[model samples]
Target: MSGRAAAEKSGAMTGANEFKLTQGPEDSVSAVKFSPSSAQFLLVSSWDCTVRLFDVSANSMRMKYQHLAPVLDCAFYDPAHAWSGGLDNQLKTHDLNTDQDTIVGTHDAPIRCVEYCPEVNVMVTGSWDMSVRLWDPRTPCNAGTFTQPEKVYTLSVAVYTLAVFQLSVSVFQLSVSVFQLSGCVSAECLVRLALVMLTRCVCFQGYVLSSIEGRVAVEYLDPSLEVQKKKYAFKCHRLKENGIEQVFPVNAISFHSVHNTFATGGSDGFVNIWDPFNKKRLCQFHRYPTSIASLAFSTDGSLLAIASSYMQEQGDVSHPADAVFIRQVTDAETKPK
Candidate 1:
């Protein structure tokens, strides 16, 4: 970890507050997200090829949309207009007001992740085909396409950069005119570390990457080498036994919008709140029974959604069902100890 981060994390610690159990999909939930306009509204994408809309305030499913294949990831461009990507490799927009669906673009392989950059009026999708393509919803046409050496497993959008990464553990930065990739985090080391960074989100100037290796890297997007030197990673979600680290993969990461503090969920079934500035966990969240596949904070950061699913780590799921958890967040959760 960087000295800057170490200096910041020295004085903070938090406890994971419990989660409010909510009914979810009959199948393993792939992602859990809150609406950009309001925290009361949430969405859950499942391997069952369905997306369920829930009224969190009411604790009821509001509407359900089914696709041709399992839905992998989704994002809202706005309250009424949103997009969903699935195993079908198709990106489609769903109109919440009318409940209508429309195709936006296509990927050669399953669309593992999608992100909306409201400032640029563009949508980005990462795929198994090893490409990241930009789409302009206004024209229903692709703005541009960029290829990577490995399968693109996740995508995230910041003010000036688009992050595309693969499970092999590399991140790429894409812009409208210039695209650059910082030094790759060695895949072998990542594998040895065993953190599966399948889910990631843009925080501010940097992106938070979680790994199955039991570490989460705080990476800088800047192309300059000196600034890049400031980037560092920390080990979390692990245990000490015989002085050997029994690390659990950090399966999910979500950044709070207002505070910039992020939350991490892991195979250990625990979710923790962190202040990247301090580079320390501010609080720990209630643990679950299964691995956390995804995490999302509402636009206002008033609510947090956690999804527990079959991560393929346990072979066959004994219960064969997924769960959803939403917790109302308070400022105290992120307060430095």
Candidate 2:
């Protein structure tokens, strides 16, 4: 085994309260999200064309369902219902109670993000077709479709606001736009900001955007000039060795529900917790075996699920095995000092 693999194995064996999922995805994991109401169940979507429901308490996969193509993202509509979209350009809902899958709708291109808005009781999907679609989860029908300036890359909904990140016509730039969701599926464009190469986004009291250039930006939803001035961007996930610097993509972000602090995972195989409100980094964990494809903190912020999967970005290199790790977190590591 390579030295890096040996070091990772040693760390996994010694890390406190950390355990690897023995029955992980066959291909790269695209998303890992916990149940909205409970931490015991986890929802995982993978490039293997499967979505799995795992019982973390029992450390076993409860069940799994298949798709025609690789699943890109998945969300829990409720405790027993899951919503997923994929390269097949199809939106599907799985009924855990009955082991049934229903085709909700289809996009013009591969679906990139799937999210459920509890406040509006709507299921929102973003696609590379350059459109955002809203669905009525109960009826599982398309409520509306809104065109975007470019291909939708990621989506995050906070309270009444929805933030959508898209690739710009310029190959080097990304556009970040925010929308206000009114009654049910009604959406109104609020603001648009341009940045460099966005890869992932997450929204809470405000919005946090990560770029392929190893940087992260924190922006607010308010339109006031003073409120907007508080927005700032910083660099991370870069290393300097032998008089050269290597930069990696920041792939995932998950917020701690109770503390409002957030964690970011990168291709550098590192996870760092930050207090965005205070502009401070709380802690940085030891490196994993490979890149972090996705991350999710349990509803109560007591556990964090890390998806360490190789993204094949380096081309024809020796790739590490894909795996998922569950770690019990503590207040000292997540809470602001």
Candidate 3:
């Protein structure tokens, strides 16, 4: 089959041949993740304010636990516990096999994102209040908090995005790095989030173009510093006029673990993979029907899982309509030049 034909046959929009894993409710899945171990368990956070663990081999729920607020995100630690954050501004860890949960730490504002760093045994939480907090997972306590300037307007509240990584142990020393992105003010915020570690130092790439009406100006930051500085280094090259108009705000970004590549998914229903070092677009996947809210790469960097949402309106009530899609990223030469 041709590339397009193969994509359509493999699932695309019909959802007929797609490997669908339904949990909670048809629309409740907010985030879906695979464990970092060899077992490859699937963990999901839902709009029902709970985190559900599934044994993918059996396609069954192994465990579920409720949180203080809607569970926005969940990730597994290296050992066995799962870490989660949500609207309650608290980070909670749960042991799936034991059915126990403990609040590890609290944020000053609604928690928007959570990630586990196994190399450092740390949990990172981002908040809508413009700050990212780091916690010790073993102790369930705050290790450090990175704060940003407060917004002047309620609509301008900073929603943070975070990524953590560890530098390779070399002849020098061992170091752990945390990267964060803050100050997003767009209907479809496409913030580029990444952690590129050299031998001893790490650099974070956070990019979101500032906009007046709809036009955007990009900004960059390195989170390792005490005073986070803006680099304003990159610009979005207009690929196509219609594409530019359709460049929905970016919702989630993931970097290739082994290469200089990264992918950005947006509300515009497009996932663009780029080479950050060369500042070139490698491939574009544009088959999504809604805004891509979150993304994850398999530990081996072979597969990508995307969480997406569509807007729904009922009388006066407004809620996000969501779904998950798993895609395989192929090499550049394998795709059409």
Candidate 4:
């Protein structure tokens, strides 16, 4: 395997030198994510049509499930059950302990991505059918579905790119914060932002907040009905194409837990960071030989874990598979003006 050495500067370290784990059942891997608890556990989705959980510290497999179609994406609902979606047009949940799984429901088209709310039992899925569906795994029924314009598969294709935050939850009601990208024609079009409110009765209230295509918006959800009355939004910047312009679609997006930062990667073979608070590009790193499949930030936002597929022509003619890179993000020094 040919590996590039990232500079040893304060903010740069060899992401390829971090902890590595190999997951085998043979299909191409689509997505891999770390739990909110940091390095404790990780969830992975594969084209082999299954979701596998790995013990990061021990580099061992804890559990696995067969979703029946190429499991395109997976996300943890907590640390226990994971929500997985794929070409089967089905949304399913897998229990990490029992190694059991059930099909919650089906979508009109293949489900491309799934995400769980940080502070609640709700989950949302994006699909090629041009709709985002919300579900309460606790109920195993449809909670809500947000429909977008026709020919808007970009939103669904980018669904794995979705992010969620809790707004509020009470004995009677629950509120969630979510955003999606629209109007992406190719690489030049800016992604438009659509923010929506989801309630327990399966009601959806959506509104457009911005028309920038590649940018990501984030918000904190209030748990109380009263606090849910306030409006807030943050934007994430995309990397500028200064070198070769490749048409790799961005597959995933992640935000730092405590910092006003976020990261995005795509088939373009680069991972870029941004300050969500100020909407400024922080820095960019490129060393992956293939498309970036997924990204995760450590609990303290100190380490970044990246999963990528290996590209051919770069060497390693045998045993071609996916690789993971871990990067350390350092704070910049302040200089007096």
* lDDT values, one for every candidate: 0.71, 0.88, 0.53, 0.56
lDDT of 3 by residue, 91-119 (tens): 88888768898887777766756666544
Estimate the lDDT of model 4.
0.56
What is candidate 3's local distance difference test score? 0.53
Superposed on all Cα atoms, the candidates' RMSDs to the truth, in angstroms, are 9.7, 4.3, 11.2, 11.4
Model 2 lDDT tens row, 1-337: 4222433554543365677765779999999999998988899999999999987766668899999999999999999999999999999999988999999999999999999988899999999999999999989799989999899999998787788888865574678778989867699998888775656655555778887788988878777899999999899989888989999899999999999999999999999999988898999988999999999999999999999999887876888889888888999999988
TM-score of 3: 0.63
lDDT string, candidate 1, 1-337, tens digits: 3212322343211224333334568787888878878887888889989888877766667788888999998887787776889899999888888988888889999998877777667777888888777787777778777776677666666654555555543454222122332222111111111233443433334667776678788876455899878778898899778998788878788888878888888887788998878778888866676788888888888778888776887677585357776666888885544
Per-residue CA lDDT of model 4 for 1-337, tens digit only, reads: 1112312322233444454454543655677777866665778788778788876555556778887678877888777888898988888888877878888998898887676654334576767675667787777778776664421222212232343222222322222223543322111122332334321011111221221233333333334666544434443323357774334345556666556456776555677776544545677776575656677776676666687764232355663357655555565411111
Judging by lDDT against the true structure, name the best candidate: 2
lDDT of 3 at 34: 76
Error of 4 at 8 (Å): 20
User: Which numbered prediction scores highest in TM-score against the true structure?
Assistant: 2
- State the TM-score for model 1: 0.81
Residue 93 lDDT in candidate 1: 87
Candidate 1 global lDDT? 0.71
Sort by TM-score, top down from the best: 2, 1, 3, 4
